[model samples]
Target chain A: MKTLWSGSREGSLLRYRAMAFTVGTGLLLLVFVGIPIQIWGHSKAVVAVVGPIHGYLYLIYLAAAFDLARRERFPISRLFVMISAGLVPFVAFIIEHRIVASLRAEERSDATAS
Target chain B: MNRESDRQVRWVAPRALVAHLLVLCFVPGCLIAGWWQATVAMSGNGLSYLYAFEWPVFAIFSVVLWWNFLHDDPDEVGGRRLRELRRDESISGERAELRSPDFRTEDEDDELRAYNDYLAQLAQRDRAKGWRSR
Candidate 1:
Protein backbone atom coordinates (compact mmCIF):
# COMPACT_ATOMS: atom_id res chain seq x y z
CA MET A 1 0.00 0.00 0.00
CA LYS A 2 1.15 3.54 -0.80
CA THR A 3 1.59 5.17 2.59
CA LEU A 4 2.49 8.79 3.45
CA TRP A 5 6.06 7.70 4.18
CA SER A 6 6.41 5.94 0.81
CA GLY A 7 7.83 8.90 -1.20
CA SER A 8 11.56 9.48 -1.73
CA ARG A 9 12.99 11.31 1.28
CA GLU A 10 14.99 13.74 -0.82
CA GLY A 11 11.94 14.53 -2.98
CA SER A 12 9.72 15.09 0.07
CA LEU A 13 12.31 17.27 1.78
CA LEU A 14 12.78 19.33 -1.36
CA ARG A 15 9.03 19.83 -1.62
CA TYR A 16 8.86 21.09 1.98
CA ARG A 17 11.80 23.45 1.50
CA ALA A 18 10.22 24.85 -1.66
CA MET A 19 6.95 25.42 0.17
CA ALA A 20 8.75 27.12 3.04
CA PHE A 21 10.62 29.36 0.63
CA THR A 22 7.45 30.25 -1.29
CA VAL A 23 5.53 31.18 1.86
CA GLY A 24 8.45 32.94 3.54
CA THR A 25 9.11 35.02 0.44
CA GLY A 26 5.43 35.94 0.15
CA LEU A 27 5.29 37.14 3.75
CA LEU A 28 8.50 39.11 3.26
CA LEU A 29 6.91 40.86 0.32
CA LEU A 30 3.87 41.81 2.37
CA VAL A 31 5.70 43.13 5.44
CA PHE A 32 8.72 44.69 3.77
CA VAL A 33 7.29 45.72 0.43
CA GLY A 34 3.52 45.96 0.83
CA ILE A 35 3.02 47.37 4.33
CA PRO A 36 5.66 50.11 4.22
CA ILE A 37 4.52 51.44 0.86
CA GLN A 38 0.91 51.48 1.98
CA ILE A 39 1.70 53.35 5.24
CA TRP A 40 4.26 55.86 3.90
CA GLY A 41 3.70 56.36 0.19
CA HIS A 42 -0.04 55.89 0.11
CA SER A 43 -2.46 56.66 2.96
CA LYS A 44 -3.95 54.98 6.06
CA ALA A 45 -6.85 54.25 3.73
CA VAL A 46 -4.55 52.09 1.63
CA VAL A 47 -3.27 50.19 4.67
CA ALA A 48 -6.83 49.74 5.91
CA VAL A 49 -7.96 48.45 2.53
CA VAL A 50 -5.02 46.04 2.19
CA GLY A 51 -4.85 44.85 5.84
CA PRO A 52 -7.40 42.05 5.48
CA ILE A 53 -5.57 40.59 2.50
CA HIS A 54 -2.26 40.55 4.40
CA GLY A 55 -3.91 38.82 7.36
CA TYR A 56 -5.33 36.15 5.08
CA LEU A 57 -1.97 35.56 3.35
CA TYR A 58 -0.16 35.23 6.67
CA LEU A 59 -2.72 32.63 7.78
CA ILE A 60 -2.15 30.64 4.60
CA TYR A 61 1.65 30.76 5.04
CA LEU A 62 1.33 29.36 8.56
CA ALA A 63 -0.98 26.58 7.38
CA ALA A 64 1.40 25.58 4.55
CA ALA A 65 4.38 25.49 6.92
CA PHE A 66 2.41 23.30 9.35
CA ASP A 67 1.38 20.85 6.61
CA LEU A 68 4.93 20.50 5.25
CA ALA A 69 6.30 19.99 8.75
CA ARG A 70 3.83 17.19 9.47
CA ARG A 71 4.46 15.42 6.15
CA GLU A 72 8.26 15.59 6.60
CA ARG A 73 8.04 14.77 10.33
CA PHE A 74 10.12 17.83 11.18
CA PRO A 75 10.33 18.66 14.89
CA ILE A 76 7.40 20.75 16.09
CA SER A 77 9.69 23.31 17.75
CA ARG A 78 11.58 23.98 14.53
CA LEU A 79 8.27 24.26 12.67
CA PHE A 80 7.02 26.81 15.20
CA VAL A 81 10.19 28.87 14.78
CA MET A 82 9.81 28.77 11.03
CA ILE A 83 6.17 29.86 11.30
CA SER A 84 7.04 32.68 13.68
CA ALA A 85 9.81 33.97 11.41
CA GLY A 86 7.20 35.50 9.11
CA LEU A 87 6.11 37.90 11.86
CA VAL A 88 9.43 39.74 11.88
CA PRO A 89 10.89 41.80 9.05
CA PHE A 90 13.52 39.97 6.92
CA VAL A 91 13.32 36.91 9.24
CA ALA A 92 11.76 34.83 6.49
CA PHE A 93 15.03 35.00 4.53
CA ILE A 94 16.96 33.68 7.52
CA ILE A 95 14.42 30.89 8.07
CA GLU A 96 14.57 29.95 4.39
CA HIS A 97 18.37 29.67 4.56
CA ARG A 98 18.16 27.47 7.64
CA ILE A 99 15.58 25.24 5.97
CA VAL A 100 17.81 24.78 2.92
CA ALA A 101 20.83 23.90 5.09
CA SER A 102 18.92 21.37 7.22
CA LEU A 103 17.27 19.83 4.18
CA ARG A 104 20.66 19.40 2.45
CA ALA A 105 22.03 17.73 5.57
CA GLU A 106 19.01 15.41 5.66
CA GLU A 107 19.53 14.51 1.99
CA ARG A 108 23.22 13.73 2.52
CA SER A 109 22.46 11.48 5.52
CA ASP A 110 19.65 9.69 3.65
CA ALA A 111 22.01 9.11 0.70
CA THR A 112 24.69 7.69 2.98
CA ALA A 113 22.17 5.38 4.69
CA SER A 114 20.86 4.07 1.36
CA MET B 1 8.89 -3.14 -3.56
CA ASN B 2 7.81 -6.15 -5.66
CA ARG B 3 6.13 -5.17 -8.97
CA GLU B 4 3.23 -7.61 -8.38
CA SER B 5 2.41 -6.12 -4.98
CA ASP B 6 2.90 -2.54 -6.24
CA ARG B 7 0.45 -3.22 -9.10
CA GLN B 8 -2.19 -4.31 -6.60
CA VAL B 9 -1.74 -1.11 -4.58
CA ARG B 10 -3.81 1.97 -5.48
CA TRP B 11 -2.84 5.53 -4.59
CA VAL B 12 -5.57 7.50 -2.85
CA ALA B 13 -6.58 10.63 -4.76
CA PRO B 14 -5.29 13.93 -3.41
CA ARG B 15 -8.51 15.73 -2.37
CA ALA B 16 -6.89 19.19 -2.29
CA LEU B 17 -5.94 19.49 -5.97
CA VAL B 18 -9.35 20.73 -7.17
CA ALA B 19 -9.75 23.23 -4.31
CA HIS B 20 -6.19 24.48 -4.88
CA LEU B 21 -6.84 25.06 -8.58
CA LEU B 22 -10.12 26.88 -7.87
CA VAL B 23 -8.48 29.27 -5.37
CA LEU B 24 -5.54 29.89 -7.74
CA CYS B 25 -7.83 30.95 -10.57
CA PHE B 26 -10.57 32.73 -8.60
CA VAL B 27 -8.43 34.80 -6.16
CA PRO B 28 -6.17 36.27 -8.85
CA GLY B 29 -9.12 36.86 -11.14
CA CYS B 30 -11.02 38.75 -8.43
CA LEU B 31 -7.99 40.86 -7.47
CA ILE B 32 -7.20 41.78 -11.08
CA ALA B 33 -10.81 42.57 -11.86
CA GLY B 34 -11.21 44.66 -8.72
CA TRP B 35 -8.04 46.63 -9.54
CA TRP B 36 -9.28 47.26 -13.07
CA GLN B 37 -12.53 48.67 -11.71
CA ALA B 38 -10.68 50.89 -9.18
CA THR B 39 -8.33 52.22 -11.87
CA VAL B 40 -11.24 53.05 -14.14
CA ALA B 41 -12.86 55.04 -11.30
CA MET B 42 -9.62 56.83 -10.31
CA SER B 43 -8.57 57.71 -13.91
CA GLY B 44 -4.93 56.51 -13.72
CA ASN B 45 -2.56 58.00 -11.08
CA GLY B 46 0.39 55.90 -12.49
CA LEU B 47 2.67 54.62 -9.59
CA SER B 48 -0.01 55.05 -6.94
CA TYR B 49 -2.50 53.17 -9.14
CA LEU B 50 -0.21 50.11 -9.62
CA TYR B 51 0.88 50.14 -5.95
CA ALA B 52 -2.65 50.51 -4.67
CA PHE B 53 -3.94 47.62 -6.74
CA GLU B 54 -1.06 45.05 -6.99
CA TRP B 55 -0.19 44.82 -3.27
CA PRO B 56 -3.64 43.74 -2.18
CA VAL B 57 -3.80 41.27 -5.05
CA PHE B 58 -0.40 39.81 -4.17
CA ALA B 59 -1.40 39.65 -0.49
CA ILE B 60 -4.63 37.79 -1.26
CA PHE B 61 -2.79 35.47 -3.64
CA SER B 62 -0.20 34.66 -0.96
CA VAL B 63 -2.92 33.89 1.59
CA VAL B 64 -4.71 31.56 -0.81
CA LEU B 65 -1.36 29.88 -1.57
CA TRP B 66 -0.74 29.38 2.16
CA TRP B 67 -4.28 28.13 2.83
CA ASN B 68 -3.63 25.42 0.22
CA PHE B 69 -0.79 24.13 2.42
CA LEU B 70 -3.06 22.79 5.17
CA HIS B 71 -3.74 19.22 4.15
CA ASP B 72 -3.98 15.76 5.65
CA ASP B 73 -4.49 12.60 3.69
CA PRO B 74 -8.13 11.55 4.16
CA ASP B 75 -8.12 8.22 6.03
CA GLU B 76 -10.16 6.48 3.30
CA VAL B 77 -9.39 2.80 4.02
CA GLY B 78 -7.80 3.21 7.44
CA GLY B 79 -11.02 4.36 9.15
CA ARG B 80 -13.09 1.55 7.63
CA ARG B 81 -10.54 -1.11 8.62
CA LEU B 82 -10.33 0.32 12.16
CA ARG B 83 -14.12 0.13 12.54
CA GLU B 84 -14.25 -3.41 11.14
CA LEU B 85 -11.39 -4.56 13.34
CA ARG B 86 -13.01 -3.00 16.40
CA ARG B 87 -16.27 -4.83 15.70
CA ASP B 88 -14.52 -8.13 14.99
CA GLU B 89 -12.28 -7.90 18.06
CA SER B 90 -15.24 -7.13 20.30
CA ILE B 91 -17.31 -10.07 18.98
CA SER B 92 -14.65 -12.78 18.47
CA GLY B 93 -12.00 -11.65 21.02
CA GLU B 94 -9.49 -13.19 18.58
CA ARG B 95 -7.80 -11.00 15.97
CA ALA B 96 -9.42 -11.77 12.67
CA GLU B 97 -7.02 -13.13 10.10
CA LEU B 98 -7.79 -14.15 6.48
CA ARG B 99 -6.26 -17.41 5.24
CA SER B 100 -5.35 -16.26 1.76
CA PRO B 101 -2.09 -15.63 -0.10
CA ASP B 102 -3.46 -12.22 -1.12
CA PHE B 103 -6.09 -11.42 1.48
CA ARG B 104 -7.95 -8.72 -0.49
CA THR B 105 -8.20 -10.70 -3.74
CA GLU B 106 -9.00 -13.95 -1.95
CA ASP B 107 -11.68 -12.40 0.26
CA GLU B 108 -13.42 -10.90 -2.79
CA ASP B 109 -13.45 -14.28 -4.55
CA ASP B 110 -14.73 -16.04 -1.45
CA GLU B 111 -17.61 -13.53 -1.10
CA LEU B 112 -18.63 -14.02 -4.74
CA ARG B 113 -18.61 -17.82 -4.38
CA ALA B 114 -20.70 -17.65 -1.22
CA TYR B 115 -23.25 -15.35 -2.94
CA ASN B 116 -23.54 -17.70 -5.93
CA ASP B 117 -24.02 -20.70 -3.67
CA TYR B 118 -26.73 -18.91 -1.73
CA LEU B 119 -28.60 -18.04 -4.96
CA ALA B 120 -28.40 -21.64 -6.17
CA GLN B 121 -29.77 -22.98 -2.86
CA LEU B 122 -32.62 -20.45 -2.94
CA ALA B 123 -33.53 -21.52 -6.53
CA GLN B 124 -33.55 -25.20 -5.55
CA ARG B 125 -35.81 -24.51 -2.54
CA ASP B 126 -38.18 -22.49 -4.72
CA ARG B 127 -38.51 -25.43 -7.22
CA ALA B 128 -39.09 -27.94 -4.35
CA LYS B 129 -41.81 -25.70 -2.76
CA GLY B 130 -43.56 -25.32 -6.16
CA TRP B 131 -43.83 -29.12 -6.58
CA ARG B 132 -45.28 -29.42 -3.06
CA SER B 133 -47.89 -26.70 -3.82
CA ARG B 134 -48.88 -28.51 -7.06
Candidate 2:
Protein backbone atom coordinates (compact mmCIF):
# COMPACT_ATOMS: atom_id res chain seq x y z
CA MET A 1 0.00 0.00 0.00
CA LYS A 2 1.13 3.56 -0.70
CA THR A 3 1.93 5.39 2.53
CA LEU A 4 3.70 8.49 3.74
CA TRP A 5 6.74 6.26 3.82
CA SER A 6 8.49 4.96 0.67
CA GLY A 7 8.26 1.33 1.90
CA SER A 8 11.76 1.48 3.27
CA ARG A 9 12.55 0.90 6.94
CA GLU A 10 14.79 3.93 6.93
CA GLY A 11 12.08 6.21 5.58
CA SER A 12 9.51 5.25 8.20
CA LEU A 13 12.04 5.51 11.01
CA LEU A 14 12.98 8.98 9.86
CA ARG A 15 9.34 10.01 9.65
CA TYR A 16 8.65 8.69 13.17
CA ARG A 17 11.64 10.57 14.54
CA ALA A 18 10.52 13.82 12.94
CA MET A 19 6.99 13.46 14.29
CA ALA A 20 8.16 12.55 17.77
CA PHE A 21 10.24 15.69 18.10
CA THR A 22 7.53 17.84 16.62
CA VAL A 23 4.97 16.48 19.03
CA GLY A 24 7.42 16.62 21.92
CA THR A 25 8.17 20.28 21.30
CA GLY A 26 4.49 21.04 20.91
CA LEU A 27 3.73 19.43 24.27
CA LEU A 28 6.61 21.23 25.95
CA LEU A 29 5.43 24.60 24.75
CA LEU A 30 1.85 23.87 25.80
CA VAL A 31 2.90 22.75 29.27
CA PHE A 32 5.67 25.18 30.11
CA VAL A 33 5.29 28.36 28.06
CA GLY A 34 1.60 28.23 27.24
CA ILE A 35 -0.22 26.94 30.32
CA PRO A 36 1.92 28.69 32.91
CA ILE A 37 1.73 32.06 31.16
CA GLN A 38 -2.01 31.70 30.74
CA ILE A 39 -2.47 30.96 34.46
CA TRP A 40 -0.36 33.77 35.94
CA GLY A 41 -0.60 36.37 33.18
CA HIS A 42 -4.47 36.11 33.07
CA SER A 43 -4.30 35.38 29.35
CA LYS A 44 -6.32 32.82 27.46
CA ALA A 45 -4.23 33.55 24.41
CA VAL A 46 -1.31 31.09 24.72
CA VAL A 47 -3.36 28.11 26.00
CA ALA A 48 -6.11 28.74 23.49
CA VAL A 49 -3.67 28.70 20.59
CA VAL A 50 -1.10 26.13 21.74
CA GLY A 51 -3.69 23.73 23.17
CA PRO A 52 -5.37 22.83 19.90
CA ILE A 53 -2.11 22.78 18.00
CA HIS A 54 -0.64 20.30 20.47
CA GLY A 55 -3.82 18.23 20.44
CA TYR A 56 -3.77 17.92 16.66
CA LEU A 57 -0.04 17.34 16.56
CA TYR A 58 -0.56 14.46 19.00
CA LEU A 59 -2.89 12.77 16.53
CA ILE A 60 -0.19 12.97 13.89
CA TYR A 61 2.29 11.62 16.39
CA LEU A 62 0.05 8.60 16.98
CA ALA A 63 -0.13 7.89 13.25
CA ALA A 64 3.62 8.15 12.86
CA ALA A 65 4.25 5.90 15.85
CA PHE A 66 1.76 3.33 14.55
CA ASP A 67 3.44 3.32 11.13
CA LEU A 68 6.87 2.81 12.63
CA ALA A 69 5.59 0.08 14.96
CA ARG A 70 3.97 -1.77 12.06
CA ARG A 71 7.17 -1.59 10.03
CA GLU A 72 9.21 -2.80 12.99
CA ARG A 73 6.65 -5.33 14.35
CA PHE A 74 7.32 -4.16 17.87
CA PRO A 75 5.89 -6.25 20.70
CA ILE A 76 2.43 -5.18 21.86
CA SER A 77 3.70 -4.34 25.36
CA ARG A 78 6.49 -2.26 23.91
CA LEU A 79 4.10 -0.57 21.54
CA PHE A 80 1.84 0.27 24.48
CA VAL A 81 4.78 1.86 26.25
CA MET A 82 5.58 3.85 23.15
CA ILE A 83 2.00 5.04 22.92
CA SER A 84 1.95 6.04 26.58
CA ALA A 85 5.23 7.87 26.16
CA GLY A 86 3.45 10.50 24.09
CA LEU A 87 1.00 11.34 26.91
CA VAL A 88 3.68 12.18 29.44
CA PRO A 89 6.30 14.91 29.32
CA PHE A 90 9.84 14.13 28.09
CA VAL A 91 9.00 10.44 27.68
CA ALA A 92 8.67 10.60 23.91
CA PHE A 93 12.23 11.85 23.51
CA ILE A 94 13.57 9.06 25.70
CA ILE A 95 11.45 6.39 24.02
CA GLU A 96 12.49 7.59 20.58
CA HIS A 97 16.15 7.36 21.52
CA ARG A 98 15.68 3.85 22.88
CA ILE A 99 13.79 2.77 19.76
CA VAL A 100 16.60 4.06 17.54
CA ALA A 101 19.16 2.19 19.59
CA SER A 102 17.19 -1.05 19.42
CA LEU A 103 16.64 -0.68 15.69
CA ARG A 104 20.35 -0.20 15.12
CA ALA A 105 21.06 -3.27 17.20
CA GLU A 106 18.62 -5.32 15.19
CA GLU A 107 20.22 -4.12 11.94
CA ARG A 108 23.63 -5.11 13.23
CA SER A 109 22.38 -8.58 14.04
CA ASP A 110 20.65 -8.90 10.68
CA ALA A 111 23.86 -7.90 8.92
CA THR A 112 25.86 -10.50 10.80
CA ALA A 113 23.29 -13.25 10.16
CA SER A 114 23.02 -12.50 6.48
CA MET B 1 -8.37 -13.59 6.30
CA ASN B 2 -10.51 -16.37 4.84
CA ARG B 3 -8.44 -19.12 6.31
CA GLU B 4 -9.86 -22.31 7.81
CA SER B 5 -10.30 -23.23 11.48
CA ASP B 6 -6.69 -24.39 11.55
CA ARG B 7 -5.55 -21.14 13.19
CA GLN B 8 -7.00 -21.05 16.67
CA VAL B 9 -7.96 -17.61 17.94
CA ARG B 10 -6.65 -17.30 21.47
CA TRP B 11 -9.05 -14.94 23.17
CA VAL B 12 -8.32 -16.13 26.71
CA ALA B 13 -4.58 -16.14 26.33
CA PRO B 14 -2.62 -14.17 28.96
CA ARG B 15 -1.72 -11.36 26.61
CA ALA B 16 -5.29 -11.20 25.37
CA LEU B 17 -6.59 -11.04 28.92
CA VAL B 18 -4.39 -8.05 29.56
CA ALA B 19 -5.59 -6.46 26.36
CA HIS B 20 -9.20 -7.03 27.33
CA LEU B 21 -8.64 -5.40 30.67
CA LEU B 22 -7.00 -2.44 29.01
CA VAL B 23 -9.91 -1.96 26.62
CA LEU B 24 -12.52 -2.19 29.36
CA CYS B 25 -10.83 0.25 31.69
CA PHE B 26 -9.37 2.63 29.14
CA VAL B 27 -12.45 3.13 26.94
CA PRO B 28 -14.71 4.22 29.82
CA GLY B 29 -11.91 6.32 31.27
CA CYS B 30 -11.62 8.23 28.03
CA LEU B 31 -15.39 8.75 27.67
CA ILE B 32 -15.60 10.08 31.21
CA ALA B 33 -12.69 12.39 30.59
CA GLY B 34 -14.43 13.54 27.43
CA TRP B 35 -17.58 14.18 29.43
CA TRP B 36 -15.62 16.30 31.88
CA GLN B 37 -14.14 18.25 28.99
CA ALA B 38 -17.60 18.75 27.51
CA THR B 39 -18.72 20.32 30.80
CA VAL B 40 -15.63 22.51 30.77
CA ALA B 41 -16.40 23.51 27.19
CA MET B 42 -19.96 24.39 28.24
CA SER B 43 -18.41 26.67 30.83
CA GLY B 44 -16.90 28.73 27.98
CA ASN B 45 -13.49 27.08 27.66
CA GLY B 46 -13.21 26.88 23.87
CA LEU B 47 -10.09 24.70 23.95
CA SER B 48 -11.92 22.10 26.02
CA TYR B 49 -14.27 21.41 23.12
CA LEU B 50 -11.39 20.17 20.98
CA TYR B 51 -10.20 18.05 23.90
CA ALA B 52 -13.69 16.63 24.29
CA PHE B 53 -13.60 15.37 20.71
CA GLU B 54 -10.02 14.18 20.92
CA TRP B 55 -10.72 11.94 23.92
CA PRO B 56 -13.30 9.85 22.04
CA VAL B 57 -10.86 9.51 19.15
CA PHE B 58 -8.27 8.33 21.62
CA ALA B 59 -10.74 5.74 22.85
CA ILE B 60 -11.33 4.50 19.30
CA PHE B 61 -7.61 4.27 18.71
CA SER B 62 -7.19 2.18 21.85
CA VAL B 63 -9.87 -0.28 20.71
CA VAL B 64 -8.24 -0.67 17.28
CA LEU B 65 -4.83 -1.16 18.83
CA TRP B 66 -6.28 -3.73 21.23
CA TRP B 67 -7.85 -5.72 18.38
CA ASN B 68 -4.61 -5.79 16.44
CA PHE B 69 -2.72 -6.89 19.52
CA LEU B 70 -5.21 -9.69 20.15
CA HIS B 71 -4.72 -11.06 16.63
CA ASP B 72 -0.96 -10.70 16.70
CA ASP B 73 1.73 -13.36 16.97
CA PRO B 74 4.63 -11.74 18.75
CA ASP B 75 7.50 -12.56 16.37
CA GLU B 76 5.68 -14.02 13.37
CA VAL B 77 5.61 -10.72 11.51
CA GLY B 78 8.91 -11.36 9.71
CA GLY B 79 10.11 -8.78 12.19
CA ARG B 80 6.86 -6.83 11.62
CA ARG B 81 7.97 -5.39 8.29
CA LEU B 82 5.10 -4.28 6.03
CA ARG B 83 6.96 -5.65 3.01
CA GLU B 84 10.15 -7.48 2.24
CA LEU B 85 12.79 -5.59 0.27
CA ARG B 86 12.96 -7.68 -2.89
CA ARG B 87 16.62 -7.63 -3.87
CA ASP B 88 18.21 -10.48 -5.79
CA GLU B 89 20.70 -11.32 -3.03
CA SER B 90 18.57 -10.43 -0.07
CA ILE B 91 17.73 -13.06 2.52
CA SER B 92 14.32 -12.56 4.06
CA GLY B 93 14.47 -11.63 7.74
CA GLU B 94 12.43 -14.68 8.78
CA ARG B 95 15.03 -17.05 7.39
CA ALA B 96 17.83 -15.12 9.02
CA GLU B 97 16.21 -15.23 12.45
CA LEU B 98 17.64 -18.53 13.67
CA ARG B 99 17.34 -17.60 17.32
CA SER B 100 13.74 -18.68 17.89
CA PRO B 101 11.02 -20.00 15.66
CA ASP B 102 7.94 -17.82 15.43
CA PHE B 103 4.52 -19.47 15.60
CA ARG B 104 2.93 -18.86 12.22
CA THR B 105 -0.49 -19.83 11.01
CA GLU B 106 -0.74 -23.50 9.97
CA ASP B 107 -1.58 -22.51 6.40
CA GLU B 108 1.43 -20.22 6.13
CA ASP B 109 3.72 -22.78 7.75
CA ASP B 110 2.60 -25.40 5.26
CA GLU B 111 3.16 -23.02 2.35
CA LEU B 112 6.60 -22.19 3.62
CA ARG B 113 7.40 -25.91 3.94
CA ALA B 114 6.27 -26.49 0.36
CA TYR B 115 8.40 -23.62 -0.92
CA ASN B 116 11.46 -24.88 0.94
CA ASP B 117 10.89 -28.34 -0.46
CA TYR B 118 10.72 -26.93 -3.98
CA LEU B 119 14.02 -25.09 -3.42
CA ALA B 120 15.64 -28.29 -2.11
CA GLN B 121 14.49 -30.24 -5.17
CA LEU B 122 15.98 -27.58 -7.47
CA ALA B 123 19.30 -27.69 -5.57
CA GLN B 124 19.42 -31.49 -5.77
CA ARG B 125 18.68 -31.44 -9.47
CA ASP B 126 21.40 -28.80 -10.00
CA ARG B 127 23.97 -30.94 -8.14
CA ALA B 128 22.98 -34.01 -10.15
CA LYS B 129 23.72 -32.08 -13.38
CA GLY B 130 27.22 -31.28 -12.00
CA TRP B 131 26.83 -27.52 -12.57
CA ARG B 132 25.07 -24.66 -10.75
CA SER B 133 22.80 -22.12 -12.57
CA ARG B 134 24.38 -23.08 -15.91
Cα RMSDs, all models: 19.3, 14.7
Off-target runs (Cα >4 Å) in candidate 2 are: A1-4, B2-6, B74-134
Quantify all predictions' global Cα lDDT against the true fold: 0.53, 0.73
What digit string (tens of lDDT, one per residue) describes model 2 on residues B1-134?
A: 34423567789988789889989999999999999999999999877999999999989989988877766664466434322223211333334354225332355667787876676565445433310112
**How do the predictions measure up, each by TM-score?**
0.37, 0.70
Q: Which lDDT tens digits does candidate 1 get at residues B1-134?
A: 25333343222334345545656776777677657756764886443554456546554644544342333222533453344344433323321233233322444576777875675565445434311122
Per-residue lDDT, model 1, residue A35, is: 73
Against the true chain A, what TM-score does chain A of candidate 1 give? Answer: 0.66
Scored by lDDT, the top model is: 2
* lDDT at A45, model 2: 87
- Sorted into a CAPRI-style docking class, model 2 comes out as incorrect
| Candidate 1 local Cα displacement, residue B25, angstroms | 38
